[model samples]
Target: MIQLVIVTVLLLVLFFGIGFILNMLMKTTWFPIYGYFAVVIVFVVYWGNAGSLTDNLTEYSYADYIPAIGGLIGAILSGSAIKALRTRGFKMF
Candidate 1:
C-alpha cells in the first residue's frame, strides 16, 4: 500500500546516494554494477547462513530479500545513468 510505496521511494533514494558515493570513490562506471551485484549476492548468502552460525535458525523469505536486491538494482541503475550522462557531456553542479 502507501507504506510500501513510501519505503520503495526511500530505498531508491538511499541506494541512489550510495551509488553516487560509489561512483565518486571507484571512478569506474561499469565496476559498480558488477560490484553491487557481487555484494548483494554475498549479503544474501551471509544472511542465509546466519542462522546456522548463530544456532538460532533464523529464516528469510523472498519478500525479505526483495527490498535489498531492489536497492542494489536501483543503485546500479543510478550509477549507470550517471555514467551515461557524463559520457554525453552533461554537467552537474
Candidate 2:
C-alpha cells in the first residue's frame, strides 16, 4: 500500500540520520552497524515483553520486526557510505 511505502521511506530517512550521527560521534565504520543491530534487538525484545506483566497480551510476531531490520540495514549502508565518501574527500551537502 501507499501508506506502507511512505512509512518505510520515512523510517529509512530517520534511521539514516541516526546512523550518520552515530558515525560522526564514533568515527568508526563498523560501530554503526553493530550499534544498530544491538539497539534493534533490545527494542524488539523490550517491545515483545512489554505486556508480560499485564493482562497476558501476546508478543509481536516475527514479521513485526521486519521493518525495523530493514531500516537498520538501510541506515548502516547509508551511514557507512557517507563516511567513506567524506573520508575520500567528497563533500556532502
- Per-candidate TM-score against the hidden true structure: 0.61, 0.64
Q: Which stretches of candidate 2 lie over 4 Å from their true place?
A: 46-63, 90-93
lDDT of all predictions, in order shown? Answer: 0.67, 0.66
**Candidate 1 — what's its lDDT?**
0.67
Across 1-93, the per-residue lDDT of candidate 2 in tens digits comes to 566666667777777777776766666556767777787666655555465523222455444555666687678776778778788997644
**Number of the predicted model whose TM-score against the real structure is largest:** 2
lDDT of 1 by residue, 1-93 (tens): 566666677777788877876776666566666767787556655566554633322365555556666677678777888788888997554
Superposed by TM-score, candidate 1 places the C-alpha of residue 92 at a distance from the truth, in angstroms, of 8.1
Best candidate according to lDDT: 1
List of clashing residue pairs for candidate 2: none
